[model samples]
Target: MQLVVGRIGRAHGIRGDVFVEVRTDEPELRLGPGAVLLTDPAATGPLTVESGKVHSGKLLIRFAGIKDRTAAEALRNTMLIAEVDPDERPEDEDEYYDHQLIGLDVVLTDGTPVGELTEVVHLPYQDLLTVKRPDGSEALVPFVSELVPEIDLENQRCVIDPPPGLIDLAEAELDGGPEQDR
Candidate 1:
């Protein structure tokens, strides 16, 4: 499967090195030198990592034949994708691949049906789960260990401990909105 490794940001310097926003936790394994990455726009290129370094916390990478800042700038916003093995997983148990969470049933602790886990949004700080409800609407639930206490892969379910207003639609519907005058 093709997994996103990093996103090419603006050109870092005049030497063809571009700043990268890493998506994968295993940067050394996925974005290291000699690693080949596929591009998103379909034309920029299937870039090969010539060199990589951490500059002021963000990753900077140089690709073969990209000789100047202008060349690197052309690759801005390109997603670097890497071919990954299906059996491979992150070493940390706390970490989860997006594929594992997709399609799992989302439910409350009391077994109240919330929705179906549809997508995982990987932000810089935290991940968010997009749960599609039976009514066809989606809710953005923060994927935190405390709020999302369990993931039963065997049973294909995710248990959520939602706080007030977390799922606004459900909260509104359940409460019938504000008191209305007859």
Candidate 2:
């Protein structure tokens, strides 16, 4: 499995240095000299990191053979990936990667399937689970333990106990209107 670690933002300066938005919590553990970065599937090979450093909470990196600003600029928006084994040790009980949550079935307490997990947005206050309904509508549910009471990864299902008016709020937002009592 290839996990995305960072995204090349832009060339920083005249040199080959490029600013990268770190996507992983373990940036320090992943970014290092001699580390290999795969931009995409069509690339000839992984780009070897000649040098790297953390700057202003982002990764500043220079790749081998990329020695100019033009060369660095060409890599903007490229995703840096690291090959990870799927059989690796498990994360802590409460922690889960966004990839693991996406595609999971989202249901009400009574097993009524409301939607499917499409994405997870990490915000400062809380993570938001983006659920795509069968009708092509979408709902952003706050991943609070109170609302999302249960998550069964193996079975690919989640039980949600939405607060009063939250489902209406989500529906209103999806419909681009204010919530009105039915």
**Cα RMSD to native, each candidate?**
3.6, 4.4
TM-score of each: 0.80, 0.75
Q: Against the true structure, whose TM-score is highest?
A: 1
Candidate 2 structure quality by residue, lDDT tens digits, 76-96: 888889776664433577677
- Candidate 2 stretches with Cα past 4 Å from truth are 13-15, 41-45, 87-90, 168-182
TM-score of 1: 0.80
Give me the displacement of residue 79 in model 1, in angstroms: 1.8
The count of residue-pair clashes in candidate 2 stands at 0
lDDT per residue for candidate 1 within 1-182, as digits (tens), equals 88888899999879999999888879999999999898998698789999999999889899998999999999999999999886676898777788778999999999999899999987879889999989898999999988899998779999999876677655655665453333
Task: Identify the leading candidate in terms of lDDT.
Answer: 1
Among all windows of 10 consecutive residues in model 1, the one with the lowest summed lDDT is 173-182
